[model samples]
Target: MGNCIICGQDVDGRICQSHEEDVVFDFRGDSPDQLVRNRFYRGVVDGYADFGVFIDLSPNVTGLLHRSEIDGRLESLDWEAGDTVYVQVKSVRENGNVDLTSSIRQSEGEFRGTLIQERTEEKLPEEVEEGNGSERSDEGNGRERGTAESDGGGGAVETGVTTEAETETEEEPEPEPVETVSEPETAAPTAEPESEAESEPEPEAEAGAEPAAETETAAEPEPREATHSEIADLPDRVDELVRIEGEVVSARQTGGPTVFELRDETGVADCAAFVEAGVRAYPEIEIGDIVRLDGEVELRHDEIQVETEALVELEGDEAAEVERRLADAMTDRARPDELTLVAHDERLEAISGNLLDAAESIRRAVLESRPIVVRHGATADGYVAGVALERAILPLVREEHATSDAEYHYVNRRPLEDAVYGMNDATNDVTKMLQDRERHDEKLPLVVLAGTASTVESEDGLEMLGIYGADRIIVDAAPADPEIAAVTDVLVNPESDDALSTGALASSLATTLNSGVGDEIAHLPAVSYWEDTPQSYLDAARDAGFDEEHVTELREAVALEAYYQSYSEKRELIGDLLFGESEEAVAAAGAPEDVAAEESLAGHIATQFREKLDTEVETAQANTEESEAAGVSVAVLDTDSYTHKYDFPPTSLLLDELHRRSDAEVTIGIAMDKLWIRAETDLDLRAVALDAAENAPNAGISAAGLRECRIEFLSGAREEVEIAVIGAVTEQFD
Candidate 1:
């Protein structure tokens, strides 16, 4: 017996079974039968052929290194005849032909240890043995002199061994079983040769136990069945067979095997089953089914996974027990301990309860493996709100799912053209979700509205989702209609009349969703405000390492990009602009020069934002007309003629810049069918629109959105609607 040089575990060779693949060997045998399959060897290049290279494993034993196994073109090899190379012995055919494949580790220095492969066994290099446990006993050598016959796969099942193998590894010097390479299931142990079995001495046994020789001749023992276990406990039971009862969260097939994400009361884990390469395993097992999985725990690439042997769906009381356990654990983990706001404000405090509910719903969706869809307006504040939640939710998604692309599959953000969740958007969402549910067995998504869908205009969309029993959460700064409160699962609209940007409200809710990202989203609320920034938010942003100037740049850069591709959610680009940190960006920008170009991308975009807004402001000021109405100074601009219809600065942004430059008591920018109003004094814009509609009954003037105090009117009644709006504005000042 020997201690494994790599892990210091007891073994028959210098390297343990767990790390046998990490070392390369020098083949000392002169026949193909002596060469072990799936073992890497050092060989001398004999010559090159048009189809492959012939490498000599020994003076008389040679193998063909096929071109198909080479990662690149066969002609790319720089090897010369007689040059030494490393290759894996893929197979030794019955016809005495050895098949070889290329090895990634070509140098002896890359391996932990090197051993000489003899006809019967492997031995460590003389120099390695000199320094590492040189003492060896005749009894140990006799005990270790046995063949580890292949189980028709890449694993070795020891034969001609009995007493030591029966004892546990921790107390005895038994050879640890070599794990099979991608085998479907563990095979039954094979008996030794009859000749060898008859030659072995009989063992003294207990009263009723059979003799060792007789036991060898008997049929192989039946495969052991596993007992139920928790998913979280699998890490401690590596290489041991166990059973787990859980609900399947997702089933994904990769190039190699089918991986099912199973969730139990404690946690979630990945269980892989293979029928063939890329073939779906256990097709009857689906997402949301309560099933019992029998598998051996193993670690692949440092992640724990179960190598499935059997999967059967449970029912009746068994299913109910698993479902109840999962629900209780999920509910406990989903609820946050307390809600913490980024900045102190009484308005946010008033809606703290709703914020908690929204956060809990989102967290629960993640634990239950439900996708979340966020809908927000295509504006700066809206994007800020949406991105804040995205940053908070993506980490949770990655932690909960075992797949690499879980973030992409679990969370989605859609930008709204207007600040209303109309029937068109609802229909699109419903159609896609229904298709996903039917085709992929996905659960209904939790729809989240940020800075949109809080008013009566979105009632139809809300009702559509409600009819399908989908979960809904509304987080907006605009006052929600009394009717919307009854429809949504959670409503987080403040009742205060003070200015509350959606970004500020959503940022607070984000912390409640995942407090780990609290520092990352602290500066978002400050970026949402166009002017009159809150002192508390400014302080928080500074504390989070973003100064006022940098925060302003982020806001402007986001606004410019939001307008360009108003419909598309540029998730990664927006995240980079807002946070200036992305592992994907760093990996793509490998070189220093490429990294330098990506640095401060938001600052460059903000510079363009300033130049374009300055040009639009200059143009709008030149075309403005000033007048007085009912002792109130009013300035109005014909936005349709003065501003570029499809340009960097939209009409709403032009109005804001123009209002900043004007000294008028009220600034109004009128387009062909819609108008935006900005006021220095308190004015109920919805009431003003109502008054105008009453004054000009045939004009069809109606309030559209509260964000910009926007009113929609029929293009044909342009003159009448404009006159009535001006009269109504003057009356508000009276």
Candidate 2:
């Protein structure tokens, strides 16, 4: 006997037959024909389209509640994105399009009924003769068969989804029984059973007819409760029937099957369940529902995924047990084995918890097969850190998936100019993710911000992602800001510490995400520094066999390549320069020339790096001007006249070099609209910008992104703004 998930009644099936009619099952089956027409179902709003609201009935089944069927305008329905709604399946077309009618009533509190009948599509109304004892059983097949001709016709293929029933199944399988606590979706249309009950009489049967007799058949095999399988074990169990249980993270309907992302204690897997042609099946399952699944493991298109056969919702004690099990396992390996610190400092120690959370979020992204997009500043440190993460995650992706090209599809490193995640970048991400969902039925990606997320300039972009439920993680050396920290899902920033560079923070976080690549990432911190290498970071590199000269070559090489496109991560080029990767011998034969060529690339780039930075510095110093305010002296450069505006060496990198050579207390590089500064002191440039704006009212000055060695002012008011900025900045020192 099994216990019903809703009422705890012991029964012969997953749910009791008595309460079957009272509940709506989460359909794990494949077809739209399986859904009962005129049946109200509980659903979550997946998103809005101009024509209707797309409501997710089950993880794999979504139905449209059209504006024509709704009581109010679609915009005034009081529904936000992802809100739960109740709607009725008015009809199911042969091509699997489900036309839904809206319900004013929502929630189970409004419904009244005892469900004695579970899902049995073959069973229909039987007419009974009023004066005779005989009855005949004959009912409509329930499917409104024919081609769907309208806007809803093409929606079946929205996500490249082919009907699983028509293509994969050889024959229509017997319909299964379903039961769950029925939650009414609207106020009265679906909730009022008394009116319908009083208006229509019981179904009648013709005289001289008999009910269909039950056929004698072979006894069915008894089903035993299945034990769960870990997703990590799936690669070894290909073609084998296995049982696994987990919470559904996401669900998307494909042309063939409804894919549910099932995540358990160990890992995550995509389990595809099928029902019928174009028709939604099992209208009750939802994302975040704890369920047990039985399926065969398969490799589809070189990627590991599961083909589901049977599924059961686990609630009450079962759900709590599964959750506790997962939590316990998470506590064990959610963080790194230990910290790979650049230096043993109190600031790093204090933020260790945040670091662990950030690392765990990246690791979880890989486990769930979601793409990881790493955005970082395009500088020596930024490239090194981004490369280190790529190195760590690529190997794991290859290990977890059967596809050789999974790295390209599952992981990406995007370089952001000036380490600022901007609105343009966020819009691009949203468009790509939405297209991927509509074209391939994949989940939204996880975004990891390394060296770029701490700046408030990224908040608008982050909020855009949050609208679609994309996860954002931040790992940076920049001091924490409360506003940015609050926006991030997991924030890893060394509070009040500016000593660590983006490279150091990235390498450390990368190691925490995947420790097997620690050796490859250990030398990264040293390669990020153009000069003044911290002793501990330098020692870590020396121990890895990189001396000062070689480290300098690496820093220069990466900087030159990083500056060229500034937007192109050039992952392979950067990875080759930093780690010297050579292709392994092919199945037949290969040459040593390939390996030799790989090692020479970095040195060649380094030579070019020196030539470029040297020329830019010479030009900058020749056009330099000096000024004094209070006791502080400043060296200012007209970047338009000196530095290359659209070439190698970004304004920030150029200013850093000029500052190193200057005897002045501060160095400012001025361009058309903004100014970049480098200072020997750690005063807040944001404060100075505010003061300058007040002193020179027409300048319109503000801190450009982070409250750092940077500020922006109106280009039209440059002369007056410069004077006020110098005065305001100097007063802070006094």
Candidate 3:
């Protein structure tokens, strides 16, 4: 029996049952699942498939492959498709019939190839020997053939004639099997095609596949990096752009933009997103709507602004749910004691209602312990109108204190006097009202006192009654009423009685009264007397008499009635004593009419007294003058007993004459003793007596001879001397 050429197995007695030819075709276009047939190849190793390992098949696809089917060795094989492998078929079926029972397994070891070739006519040496039955038999035949060929040099050709019979046998068809079993006992093994034949050589395709595989590996995206916690925790920067998602606690659509507040559990932030689409888009974003927004943050003075780019509305329930979740998150992270929910709802309400009151409440809550500013307003009448307080002092003031219907401003709890009036008018009003009420023992509440000035002025009997008392007036540094100085006692300290001056008050009152009276009674005679008057008695006589010429003459000769009338009362009595009582007696006697006559007689009497007095005065003046002119000493003494004791000579008369004559220096002294005069000139005795004592009877007097006179003059006087004079004497008689 001969052996099979492909596997070195004996196949001499066996018909060529496994002989078959397969038409090689590229099946690469078909999907991997469709490529296999039969139960053995269903999920088993079929041919070496070139589909990319982990690359082509997703995790889901690769997971379906059986590990045992992939490679024969279970314990050693990795079983992942990524590992390279060789698959082999143990059986094949005819006419599209697949015997699933036919086994398919991977090769356990390395593979080797076998060859099949057509038969040749020349016998091999081994075959020749076996046919001859001896090694020497083939050797003798070969030697005889070689010796004969060498001697004859002739090549031998032999032809066997079985061609017709062989050709007939090859052309005949084989008979069908008598009994055909539907299923075979053992399936014939089928050879697996080489990996290079099974998979088309596609270098460019693999090259292309490699980049795609690489690109996919590269295309796998990574998770984004998280922002720093601290940076994220801060409020948005002044002008940064950002996005925030929250529920709309409140929404307001003005003519310009839709302003709304977004409240996350963390805090409320103001957002103003402009929507030209009207309320259809904006108003729909209600107070409870969940919204996601993109906006820019801006800081203006003391406030923060968020300008919105986009605002997406969400369902109310969803928004509430989100709000609750956010609240929970914030609450979980916040300190328990200090937990505060600064939600949009609360802030919206705060801004809408009494902002000032809200600010006050917030100030009380947040800045309760801090110092506050108190500011108050002053009215035109110097009264307090209003008050405002703040906790912190600002360097610059924004509002001015109003006066006369103006508003008041405050800074840091201090009154801003520069901005407003300095006076507290309200306090003044209150004081006045309280005083008024108190005087009547009235128990009026302060609330009633808080009314306006006009209201208080209209109150019954309260106009005249000021606070304190009528005299108790406010004396401010700045007085509103000009007449206040005239009415009230403006003392430096109004509260103290010692500061009050009654005389000054009376003077003020008199001045006021006089001013009032003077305006009406300015033309009366008594009043005119205090002003300028007529020149003299002659001028008065001219006014009262009949003829100016006669009156002038009469005034020269005697007194006129106008003259008498012109004299004040005290002067008139002296005139009457000098004149007589009747006119007849004077006319009959050829004297002036008694009125004129008495005036004439009185004139004569006065003339007699004056002439006698004048003679003595002239003589004394002459003597004093002569003495002074001659540079001599002169002295005079009064000899009248009563005069000696009681009267002192008038020195002013003598000094007057002496002053006219003497240029020399002089000195005078007075005591109780006799008169002593000394001068640089010699005086005549007559002139000395006449000038020294004009109306006195002169006793002969000399300085050296006056010791007895001095004693007599000194008798009734105090023991002290009475008069003395001293001067430079040109000559002295010793």
Candidate 4:
């Protein structure tokens, strides 16, 4: 007996009542397998011709159908590796592999009936055919045979018939008899039909198709995913090669790669053209060179399309002329508008001729407009003009008896006297000649004269001596030796009239000692005293008490004496302290003993004291004389008290009296031993007053005995005082 799976009915050699069009079969062979209706699936064709159709099932693998298996309609389907299709399991082979199909064919009679029914709207073609023909006959025959076989020897049993016609014939012969034989087997109970229905569909197709798809798809790999841009543009993922052209704005070789900045009319990009050989192949390509390259478009940090294969340089100009012009403009713009030329000896020799010519040209240009002021010096016939020139020769000139070397003497003159002499003798001489030439003859054409002041003087003397009376002299203006006021007056115009004055000029020149030559040249010198003293010191002295001539002589002598004395005192002091007899005696006396030793010590000490006293005397005399010359009064107060011994309070009182009595608002008090004096008023008055007081009766203080002094004055009605003690005097007294 056999059971019909579709209807759960007991029968033998007869069909079950339920006959579904598409049914699944579970085939229990050596391996468990399943079979599904062929109509449920559609196959897809891919690149592999052997597998024209693809069946995708659980385990998610692809099943390939042979090209011959695909319906003829799909033979021309040009598919690729990444194609997809639908398929169903037709049957499971004994090998546990799938038999896939897109669709099943109906009998010829069923097909004709289906077409006629669609036209006439009659009952469904499948239903009409089921009634007319031997429906379920195939299934009946399959059940009958299965029953007979199970009953006979329990061998393999087949459920579905091979063909409907064969099943009909077999069923007719033994219908009743087979039914009776299968009734006992079919009568056994089984699980609910719905439960079986829900579970069977999935595994039925998968178990059969999965393995075949796995084998086929595994052999041929899937294509890679396309990039976003590529996906948006193309329907497939494939390697693409392209060519783009742009002008090379900049090119450089780095890390064996030629990086170029390429620019088209629309935009610019950084393109790297790597050449394995070397950059030498493109020798003509440089910065701003244009080039073209070919390579693959690869995605890097930001879709960097590199052309590492080949590159070629295009023809273009270097733009050298444009670059040169830009560089020149920048250089010219960076230069200062004004420059100061410092006149030095070496500089004079270098540009003397050019300076002279410039000065002459300037003089000629300005002569028609203004009268030139003449000063006494070499090249006195010419006048210097304030004008721009290529060069100004500065000739140094010196005085005949000047202790400095002749080479350091006469030179070109500064715009001012103070500036001329303020410079070193060599520089001063050069300045003096320029100033002299500028000041001398109003009609004399300007010419820069370069040399030391001594040279100018020597030349002038020689000229004067040589030609009885030479009226004209030619020389160059030493622009290198710039006078501050001259430079300022000619270049930067200051509002103060004092700027043009001799006093101002001296101050300006003094200010230039530390500043550069150009700054010093801004102001011209006022009094060009090339006689040796700094014009500033002379001017200060004249402003103090001396006349111009006396101040000049005094300043010159002081300056010269200071120079000599500085060296002399250093030598003398060194000798006396270190290598002289006094040092030896002091050392010897330290070890001496007895009366003879004491006498030696006493002699040394006394000699030292006397020497100190003499020095103090000289200093005190100078101070006293200076005070007296400035005017002050001397007074003496004698008392038993030690407080009054060296006090000059009385002198202060006297100064107060003098201030009250005279128009002077300030006074100076001097005190020495038991005498004191007060010089009240201005510098002149104080000097006179101090002289008179020192000579007064019973004062006892002389110019040589003065010990200390204090200056007392009223600054805007406020009382102020400063004291100065004579160190030499204090030492002598001690």
Tell me the TM-score of each prediction against the true structure.
Answer: 0.69, 0.63, 0.17, 0.15
TM-score of model 4 vs. true structure? 0.15
| lDDT (C-alpha, whole model) for all candidates | 0.77, 0.67, 0.28, 0.29
What does candidate 1's lDDT look like per residue over 1-734, in tens digits?
88877788988867777888888887655468888778888887754433467776764466888777888977578875546789999998776768898998889999888887765467867744542222210110111123343343798544434433443332222333333222324331222233443455655568997655644544454445576688777768876778888899877554344668888877778787755433567888878899887777775434677867567788889889888988899889998888888889889888778888899999999988888999998889999999999989999888786544457667989889888898999998898687556534567899999988888888999889989878999999988889898878899889896888999999999988899998889999999999988899999999988889988988999999999879778887997788866655544544344543234676778889999999999988898889988888889899899889999898887888889889998899888899888887777878989999998898788888766689999999887888789888878776
Q: Model 4: per-residue lDDT, tens digit, 1-734?
A: 44443465674412233432332221211111323334232222212321244433321122445544666734355443223344445665544446666533322222111111111122332435443421211110112212222323576332212234544443222111111111233221111123333334433445445555544433422322212221112112113333334444444333123445443322334444432211322445554444444333443222243432344553334234433433454344322233223222232334334333333333322212111211221210111121111111111111111112111111212222111212243233333333323321112222222211212223332232123221222222221223322221121122231212222222222222113323322212212232343454344434434345433332222222222222121222222221122434455756443323323443454454334334433333333322222233332222222223232222322333333443322333332232233333112223422443443423322232111133222222111111221211222222
Sorting all predicted structures by lDDT, with the top scorer first, yields 1, 2, 4, 3
Q: Cα lDDT for residue 691, model 2?
A: 86
Q: Please list the residue runs of candidate 2 whose C-alpha ends up more than 4 Å from where it truly belongs after superposition.
A: 1-229, 250-260, 270-286, 298-305, 311-320, 342-347, 365-371, 395-410, 422-446, 455-471, 496-498, 583-598, 627-633, 706-708
Candidate 2: 10-residue stretch with minimal lDDT: 135-144
Deviation from truth (RMSD, Å), model 2: 17.2
Cα lDDT over the full model 4: 0.29
**Best by the lDDT measure:** 1
Decide which is better by lDDT, 3 or 4: 4
TM-score of candidate 2 on Cα atoms, chains taken together: 0.63
Best by TM-score: 1
